[model samples]
Each structure stands twice: as structure tokens, then as C-alpha cells.
Target chain A: AQSVAQPEDQVNVAEGNPLTVKCTYSVSGNPYLFWYVQYPNRGLQFLLKYITGDNLVKGSYGFEAEFNKSQTSFHLKKPSALVSDSALYFCAAEPRTGANNLFFGTGTRLTVIP
Target chain B: SAVISQKPSRDICQRGTSLTIQCQVDSQVTMMFWYRQQPGQSLTLIATANQGSEATYESGFVIDKFPISRPNLTFSTLTVSNMSPEDSSIYLCSGAGGPSYEQYFGPGTRLTVT
Candidate 1:
């Protein structure tokens, strides 16, 4: 079975400060990881994904995530968070060798303080 | 990446009623999926709507409760039947490519059952 774990329920970051939302996963082999954002009363927006190759991957809205294979973690990061970045973040894991099954973590709420 | 859209951005209905949410994709897709998200939880896969077959529902989800239709390669609909307060949540539609392997999500439909 494949699953993802997000240790934090909420993360608070000051505007212009760096932000990190932690995520980890348990899958059989190399996993395809993804990050998504959701605003209140809205649907999820794709943030980024890590399939292979580079350890660090950059994505939309100046967001990036580091895929650490040894740690089984892919933590989302941003050098400078904005108030607009405050939203719910979700991490997902998909088996690269499967028929496209994506298992998502229980979301993390991000609050960028002014 | 493909653009996805969902209809009935939101709807409020009394108990025992049913509501159908429509999803449209700008480009042709092979795999279209439906998901459900509770107030603060991550998304759960509801069903996989193939272009010309019965939807493959996940555990604890049934076709009777959530009927799905995939009339073609770019359009799908999901109907939540016999709604109750527990059914109140955000419904999202996603389309993923076979070769590019990127998943695109729709804005989602917010359903409130009273």
C-alpha cells in the first residue's frame, strides 16, 4: 500500500520569511511526488511535482520542493512567503510503476502572517 | 498540462436530494478522476471515470451513492445521490495525461446538504 504523511496540521510563516511544509511518504519504489494548494471555497491548484532527476524542483508561484529520497520526504519551500500564499497544502505520492494511483496526505494549512 | 472545469461551482440542497457536478476538459484525456474532500481533510479518490466503461470506485464508495458517467474522452459527470449533511464537501475533477504524466485539477464544486 502507498500513503503519505504530513506531520504538521498548520504552519505559520511571516511574510518575506522562508516557509516549509513537511511531507513524507511510504511507497514500494521511487515515488512521484506532488504538491497542491487550495484556497478557501476553491478547488486545488497544482503546485509542483517530482518525478525523477533533480533533488530540488521549482514550481508555480515561486514555490519549490526538495525531494529527499533517503528521508522519504518532499518538503515544500518558499524563500519569501506572501499573504496570498496562505492556504491549504497537500502532498501526494504516486507509484511511478503503477497504472496511475495517487495517494494524498492529510493537508497542511499555511498561514503567512503580515 | 490540460485545463479542467467543473460546473455548479456551489449548491445547497435539502436532505435526500441529489446533485450532479459536471467536469469538462479542454483537451482530450485518458484518465479522469473524481475526488472528495471533507472540511479539513485531504482528498479521497471517489472513482476513476474511463471514457467508455463503468467507473472504478475506491473503497467505501459505491456507484449507487455516487453515480459517474464518462460519455467521452473530455467530459464526465458525478452525481451525489441521497445527500445528507455528511455528504457536504468539496468535489473535484482531475485529468491526467498518459505520456506527459501531469495531472490537472478543476476548480471544484462545493456541495452543502442541509
Candidate 2:
């Protein structure tokens, strides 16, 4: 089976501080992980993804995530949080199963305060 | 990667009514997917749209309730049938050029069934 888990339902951070949204995955084959953001009334935007490369992958909007094979984790991280970054974040994993479908985690709502 | 767009960015419909959402990809893509995100919840994939075949639905989703169409490589549609308040949420469309586990999303259609 393939699944994604987001540990936190909400993450609160002060603007300018560091932020991290945790994610872990379990799959039969190698994992392909991705992060996406959704604003209040907008569609999800692709933040980044990890296929096969360096442990750390940088993505849009000054965000990056580190893929840990041993831990089975790919967590989203931002060096400095912004109020604008406050939104719903989701982690997804794609296992090369029957249809190569994306399995999404329960979202994390990040609230960045100024 | 491809740019995607959905029609009627947001709409409010009455119970028992149906809403058709259009998904357009800027470039040719081999696969397109429809997803549903309920309020304060993570995304759940509804179906996968292939260019010239029937949509492959995920568990708990059915073609009668959520029919999909993919006339070509760049255009598709997903219709929400007999909607209810529980159906109020964000509907997103995503596309991928190939099966690389890297998907790009559209702006999303916000549907509110009253």
C-alpha cells in the first residue's frame, strides 16, 4: 500500500522565523514526494517535488524540502516565514502502482503571525 | 510541465443540481486528474482522465456521480452530479506530460452547494 502522513493539523509561526511542516510516506516502491499550497479560494500551486537527486530540493517561493530515505520523510521547510506564507499545505506521494496516482496527505494549515 | 485552467472559478449551486468544471491544459499532456478537497480536509483524488478512454475512478468515487471526459490531450471536463452541501469544496485539475510523478495543477474551481 502507498500512503502519506502529515503529522500536524496546524502550525503556527512568527513571521521571520523558521517554519517546518512534517511529512512521511510509506510505499511499496521508491517514493516520489511533492508539496503544494492552497490559498483560501485558489487552486493548489506546486511548491516542489523530489524524484531522485540530492537530499535537499528547493522549490518556488523560497521554500525547500529535504528528502530522507532512511526516515521515509520529505518535510517542507522555509528559512523565514512570512504572513503571506500562511495557508493550507499538503504533502503527496506517488507510488508506481496500478495507475501511478497521487496519494495526498491530510493538509496542514500554517498560520504565520507578524 | 503545463499550465492548467478551470472554469467558473467559484460557484454556488442548489442541492440536486450538477456542476460541470472545465480543465484546459496549455500543452499536450498524457494524463489528467480530478481531485476533491473538502473544507478543512486534505485532497482526495476522484478520477484519472485518459485522452480517449473512460475515466478511471478511485475508491469511493463513481462515474455516475462524477463523470469525466477527455476529448484530446489538452482538454477535459469533470461534472459533479446531484450535488449537496457535503460536496462544497475545492475541485482541482492536474496534468502531467508523462508518467514521471511530477504533476502541475490548474487554478481550481471552488464549488459551494447550498
Candidate 3:
């Protein structure tokens, strides 16, 4: 089984401060990790993915994530937060073997306060 | 990356009625997946659809309740039967390209059963 966990239900950050949304995973084999953002009444937009290469992966909208194999974590990060970056963030993982369907976390709501 | 579109972006239906959501991909894809996201929650995989084969559903989801069709490589449909308030959720369709397991998603169908 492949599963991801997002401990925080919501995160609040000041407009110019750095922000981090935590994610952890458990999988049968190697994991393919992904981050997606969903705005109000819209579909999910892909952010970034960690497959096999560098642990640090940069994504759109000045967002990035660091994949730590030992910690079994892939935490999304932003150098500086913006009010427009507020949205729902989801972390998903797929096992290298077996099924290709992704298992997603419960999601984290990010609020950037101006 | 493949572009996916879903029809009837949002709908309100009466209880016991059924609604079928269609997903179309710009290019051919080998696998299509359906997912559901409840209000303020994460996503759950409903089923996996492949052309020329019966859809594979995840646990707690039955084929009778959520019938799926993958008649071709570029299109699929998911029908929600005997709709109830509990079934009110945003349904999303995603497609995976050739060798890359990265999945791209549609805008999602917001189904509200009243």
C-alpha cells in the first residue's frame, strides 16, 4: 500500500515569510511523489514531482519541495509567501510497482495573510 | 503533458437520479483514473479505467454504484448512480501518459445531490 499523510489541516503565514506544508508517506517500494494545488472551484494544477533524481524539486508559482528518503517526507516549501498563493495543497504518492493510482493525503489549506 | 477536460463542470441533481461525467483527453492515454474529493478533504481514487476492459474499482467503491466506461484511448465516462447527499463531491478524472506515471487532471465535475 502507498499512502501519504499531511499532518496540518491548515497553515497560516505572513506575506513575505517562508512557508512549509509537511507531508509524509509510506509505500511498498520506491515512491513517486507529487504536489498539486487547487484553487476555489477549479481543478488541480500540478506543482512538482519527485521520482528518482534530486531530492529538491522546484515547481510553479515559486513553490518547491524537498524529498527526504530517510524521513519518508516530501514537504512543500516557498521562499516567500504571497496572498495569491493561498489555496488547497495535496500530496500524493504512487508505489513504483503494482498499481499506478495515486494515494493522496487529507490536504492542507494554506492561508497567506497580508 | 496531456490536456484533459470534463463536461458539466458543476451540477445539482435530485436524490436517486444519476449523472454521468465525461472526460476527454487531447491525446491518447493508456490509463484513466477517477477520483472523488469531499468538501474540505483530500482525494480518493474511485476507479481505474482502461480501454477495452472493465474498470478496476478501489475498496469501498462498487461498480454498480459508480459505473465507468473507457470506450477509447482518449475518452472515458463515470456515472454516479442512485445519487444521495453522501455522494455530493467533486469528481476528477486524470490521465497518465506513456512511460511517465505523472498524471494530469481535468477541471473536475462538482456534483451536488439534494
Candidate 4:
């Protein structure tokens, strides 16, 4: 089974400060990890993904994630947070071999305070 | 990147009725998926809608309860049957396309079963 975990339910960060939303995964095979953001009343917007790539992956809206194999983690990061960055973040994972259905973690709500 | 759209951005429905949510993608996609996110919960894969075949449902989700249809590569629908308050959720549709084959999601349909 492929699953991801977001340890934090909510994360608060000051504007212009770096923000990190933690995510970890468990999969039977190589993992395809993804990060998505959802604003209130809207659908999810893809942030970035890590397949077979470099350890650090950059994504939309000035966001990036580090894929740490040893730690089994793919934590989302932003160099500078904005108040508009407040949203729900989800981490998803799937096995590279079969069943591409993504198993998502309980979301982490990020609130960037001004 | 693939652009996806869903109809009935938000709806309030009575219990015991069924609502079919439609998903349309800008480009042809081999795989489309349906997911449900209950209040404050992570997204759960309902089924995989592949063109020209019956949808493959996930565990705890049955075709009878959540019927799916994929008429073509760019279109699919998911019908929630016998609605209840427990079924009140945000339903999302996503498709895999482009060179990376990464998934892109549609604006979710917020279904409120009253």
C-alpha cells in the first residue's frame, strides 16, 4: 500500500519567512510523490512532483519540495511566505509499478500571517 | 499540462437523491480519477475512470454506490447514489496528461447533502 502522512494539521508562518509543511510516505516500490494546494471553495492546484529526479524539486507559485529518500519525506517549502499563500496543502504518493491511484495524506492547512 | 473543468461547482441536495458530477479535460487523457474529501479529511480515491472500460473502484467504494463513466478520453462522470449527510463532501476529478504524465485536477464540486 502506498500512503503519505502530513504530521501537521496547521502551520503558521510570518510573511516573508520560509515555510515548511512536512510530508512523509510509505510505499512498496519507488514512490511518485506530489504536492497540491487548495484554496477555499476551489479545486486542488498541482504544486510539484518528484518522480526520478533531483532531490530538490521546484514547483508553481514559488514553492518547492525536497525529496529525502533516507528520511522517507517530501516536505513542501517556500523561500518567502505571503499572506495569499494561506491554503490547504496535500501530499500524495503512488507506487511506480502498478495502480497509479494516488493515496493522499490528511491535509495541512497553511496560514501565512502578515 | 492538462486543463480540467467540472460542472456544478457547488450544490445543495436533499438526502436520497443522486448527483452526477461531470469532468472534462482539455486534452485526451488515458487515465482519469475521482476523489472525495470529507470535512477536514484527506482526499480518498473513489475510482479510476479509463476510457473504453468499466471504472476500477478502490476499497470501501463500490460501483453501485458511486457509478462512474468514461465515454471518451477527455470526459468522465461520477454519480453519487443514495446521498446522505455522510456523503456531503468536495468531489474532485483529475487526469494524467502531457509529457510528464502528472495529474491535474479540476475545480472541485462541493456537494452538500441536506
Local accuracy of candidate 1 as per-residue lDDT tens digits, B1-114: 798999999999999999999999999988899999887888999988978889999899999999999999999999999999999999999998862266788988989999
lDDT string, candidate 2, A1-114, tens digits: 668999999999999999999999987687678998988777788899998989999999999999999999999999999999999999998886547578899989999999
Query: What is each predicted model's overall lDDT from 0 to 1?
Result: 0.91, 0.90, 0.92, 0.90
Residue-wise C-alpha lDDT for candidate 1, range A7-60, written one tens digit per residue: 999899999999999999998788789998888877778899998899999999
Which predicted model would earn the best DockQ? 3
Point out the worst 10-residue segment of candidate 2 chain B by lDDT. Answer: B96-105
A1-114 in candidate 3: lDDT tens per residue? 567899999999999999999999987676788999999988888899898889999989899999999999999999999999999999998877646788899999999999
Pairs with steric clashes in candidate 2: none
Of 1 and 2, the candidate ranking higher by lDDT:
1
Candidate 4 recovers a fraction of native contacts equal to: 0.64
Compose the digit string of candidate 2's lDDT tens values, residues B6-29: 998999999999999999999998
Stretches of candidate 3 exceeding 4 Å from the true structure: B98-100
Q: How well is each residue in B1-114 modelled by candidate 3, as lDDT tens digits? A: 899999989999999999999999999988899999998888999999978889999999999999999999999999999999999999999998733367889999999999
Output the better candidate (2/3) by lDDT: 3
How many times do residue backbones clash in model 3? Answer: 0
Ranked candidates, highest TM-score first: 3, 4, 1, 2
User: What is the C-alpha RMSD, rounded to one decimal, of candidate 2?
Assistant: 1.7
Better of 2 and 4 by DockQ: 2
- lDDT (Cα, tens digit) per residue for candidate 4, span A27-107: 767678899998987888889999886999999999999999999999999999999999999998877755677889999
TM per candidate comes to 0.94, 0.92, 0.95, 0.95
What fraction of native interface contacts is shared by candidate 1? Answer: 0.49
